[model samples]
Target: PKRKTVEKHGRDLRDIIGQQQGKRALEIAAAGNHNLLFLGPPGTGKTMLASRLCDLLPEMSDEEAMETASVASLTQSEINEHNWKSRPFRSPHHSSSMAALVGGGSVPRPGEISLAHNGLLFLDEMPELDRKVLDSLREPLESGEIIISRAQGKTRFPARFQLVGALNPSPTGYYEGNQARTNPQAILRYLGRLSGPLLDRFD
Candidate 1:
């Protein structure tokens, strides 16, 4: 497919104010393809920071572009020529199912992680997701690909994408401060929804 020239526009890191640590972390993640997690209160620009990480990423190589486009073509009707060479940025909602996050069905279609191949996967409100759904990502995060097996057959999809996650420190979106509404025990349980192994995957 002939690639079209498209003007890329996105949130600039420069426009965000007063998050030196977050900005630095984004730079490091972009440079090394590291998985990242942002923990803070609500309305702290965690999602904003995650969204802009893609802008900092370098252009996809031809091979990478083809790999990413191929996965997208499976789910989308057509790949936009102007964005064919661009890296994918998939942000599945916190309530996504295991199949939705990883990939599954009677026919085994690619999921958000697969579609984000060679690009980025942003998970906002990370701890709010079902534990099972989040843990399903463990293998792919380490192996750079996912294998879907069904009674009829098995299929594999590439999933080598950087993961960026954001979440509040507590259920009420506050923690260990004067305005905190949730108790320490409840807060621990809320954050505990993310298993140790899953949390270990992030830098």
Candidate 2:
């Protein structure tokens, strides 16, 4: 049987206007495989910049492709020639459960972090996510894998992927100078959803 293939298209860094610092940060993070966090107001092109990191990354090696494919296969996700060598990009919603984000089930399945192995995981609206859910990423981020324990046994899934997070500086999405809509305490409370340890994981 002939293998089917599909083309993978991603946003280009060139399409984004200005944000020179953001672009440079993406480039550095891509080059070093470091985690990144973008803190700014809405409409600042944070997500747009994060989307371009995968485009900046190099093609996956054969081993990397196989590892990624194996995880996808477990999830029954489609794999094709075009994406076989390309890095993955996973963006889960803030409301996602810990199990959903970190992988869980009676049978144990790969979660967003595992699916993003050898690629990038973009967490938009970072501060909006549950503190516990966000904290769950700490271990995997450092260990490069997640161990999901079950009554039957423990299943380990590769999760060595760059983490790119985006969030507004304040709850109202305005925090600079006179444009700030909320009090400093309120902003602190909003940003407080992300733990200190989790923030330490990023570059």
Candidate 3:
């Protein structure tokens, strides 16, 4: 038997997740059409909160659902038959590449970012990814769509997403008091990974 469609009264994710700041950020992502970066230490429940955004959000429009669904199809992800129930949430590893994050391959495919189009791109361990690959995000982050210019012509895919990135403060991931040795140079270098121009684009 087919499942029934039930009316959901938009239970605020904040009520569910309970992180005031993170919930506020999600609200902005839902309202102003902005992307966000959640900077904090590990085990902060960033992932779980990011996931619930789909549930609290208003349902996706049909055109939106289809475009959103197409992006999901590129991946091996067997989208929930109810994929159209809400917006998508795609989380990729830090090892993801420019092509993998942006969308490319021999056969030409949608990458994680593309898959997150009209939804959310939750990037865990933001700094560990190749600087070049991470830099590539600057474009889609601004354009909301990627133009895959190839010899066969150009193919554009929607990439309008709320980018939520999380990264450790340092390689060792810790803070050191006065007596402890903390590398200021390393901190500068790590932060330098996200170039000035790229950083300027994000909210």
Candidate 4:
């Protein structure tokens, strides 16, 4: 089953249209387990390309598969029959809170990053995410783990996965034209959501 899944992913990857540079970057990220940020205007294939990283990634070993499954179980994320060993790919909406991304609640549950253990966490529209929410990922990205503390207790979730972030170049989602919609100051403010320390974590 795992072999078939990997073959199917490879076939899907071959069908992606002309994205030599993006493909190359994905290959490197998959090979080295590095974090990457793709900056461009909307409609650029950033999301599509980021989603294809699973194709190049190797299959999870039994221990990894079990650990990943445990996180999913903790989060109550549905695990289909054939997807138990498949690599996880989590992409939360831009409005997600720090708790949603890093994991927190009255009882504490695995968030997107933890659910993506031994897999990929793709953050599309990176700049649209709140500054604090974005900053919350820095620690996990560095330690390959996340700790959610609640009134009950502290819950630790595995977050060792490659991060693929996609964002526009500016506030207006374009740099070439539409000057009336955005200015240098607006662009600075928009990009400021991604703090310097957080940005430093990406490769």
Candidate 5:
């Protein structure tokens, strides 16, 4: 059964046009459980490729599937009898606040990363995210879990999932060397939204 699943995934990968490099990177990331960053212009299938990663991954163990479903249930994520076994692939908007990504409130709850346990957490247009929100992931990325502390107590959520981020090379979504590109100073500031420390967490 597992072999058939992996074979089906391989066939799906073969259907992607061009981007041999992207396929190789995906293989490496999946094999080594490495975090990945995709920098490219729009319409390049960055999001599409990231979404297919879960399909390539091995089927979840029974315990892993159950734990993942529990988090989904806790987050009130529209769970039903079917589709509960599907591994999560959460992509919160760039405007999401630190609390939204990391989980916090008068009543603590699992955030996107937690909800993505045993699966993938994709951040598209990564630099558009608030620096603090991006930075909040640093610890959890390393620790493979998140601890949300409320006034009452702390709740821990599993976050041992692969991280995949996609971003355009420049704010203009075009080649940086283009004549009409934003000035160097402006470009630097734009990219600076992703701080050095936060980027350090990604492989």
Candidate 6:
């Protein structure tokens, strides 16, 4: 095997996510069968932390690598042209619509979440995402797959990927602040998007 050895790259996933619990959490996610949410303020390194998992993952197999590459190729041809070594990583903005996150256009292209199959879906500012769009994740979260039904037809894509989400404690993205008193409604409205069923599926 001419493959290069794994690189710590001056950091490990556990360091950014330091803690016994977090270490165990990373263990579960690496298995590619769990969902996770990070509750913290800004500059906490949630994105950087999840990014390091690629370095730790024992490089993808040919079939797993191809499936991942194919999805990425649907978005960018260059990524698929080369032989990929790591799993895909998708970070979608909060304002993106349901179709963009879960995948559905007239022609039915894969969305950010689908593009991240067999890899990671990092949703920064998870609460800031539209309620409908956030709620749309419930189905795939359970089935480990996403089914997009369009007027043309239905497309099923493998979505068995780990979900990593980061969100602010308050709508203002603060933890302890007097401003929270004035913006109480904003916090409630933002969190209100997460329904009971959806929340239940996450654990």
Query: Which has the greatest TM-score?
Result: 1
Candidate 4, residues 1-203: lDDT per residue as tens digits? 45533333334467788989998888888888889999988888899898888867877888999999888888678875565667888999999988888888887887899988999999999988988888888888889899888777788888998889999988778878654378788888888889899889888
Candidate 1: minimum summed lDDT over ten consecutive residues — where? 77-86
Per-residue CA lDDT of model 3 for 121-203, tens digit only, reads 88877778888888888888888888888888888888887777776666555555543255889876876787787667667
* RMSD of every prediction: 3.0, 3.8, 3.8, 2.6, 2.8, 3.1
TM-score of each: 0.93, 0.91, 0.83, 0.91, 0.89, 0.81
Colliding pairs, model 2: none
Instruction: For model 6, name the residue pairs that clash.
Output: none
Question: If both were scored by lDDT, which would come out higher, candidate 1 or candidate 6?
Answer: 1
Model 1 C-alpha lDDT versus the unseen true structure: 0.89
Which digits, one per residue and each the tens of the lDDT, describe model 1 over residues 56-166?
Answer: 988888999888888888988366586677677889988899889999988899999999899899999998899888889999999999999988878999999999999
lDDT of 6 by residue, 40-74 (tens): 66776566666655555566778888888777778
The Cα local distance difference test for each model comes to: 0.89, 0.89, 0.74, 0.85, 0.82, 0.73
Tens-digit lDDT track for model 2 on 106-191?
98998999999999999999988888889989999999999999999999999998999999989889877677868889998999
In model 4, the worst 10-residue window by lDDT is 3-12
Q: How many clashes show up in model 2?
A: 0
Query: Could you tell which candidate, 2 or 5, scores higher by TM-score?
Result: 2
Q: After aligning candidate 3 to the native by TM-score, how far in Å is the CA of 96 from where it should be?
A: 1.1
lDDT score, residue 182, model 3?
52
What is the full ranking by TM-score, best candidate first?
1, 2, 4, 5, 3, 6
Query: Per-prediction count of colliding residue pairs?
Result: 0, 0, 0, 0, 0, 0
lDDT score for residue 186 of model 6: 73
In model 6, which runs have C-alpha deviations exceeding 4 angstroms?
1-11, 14-24, 80-83, 182-185
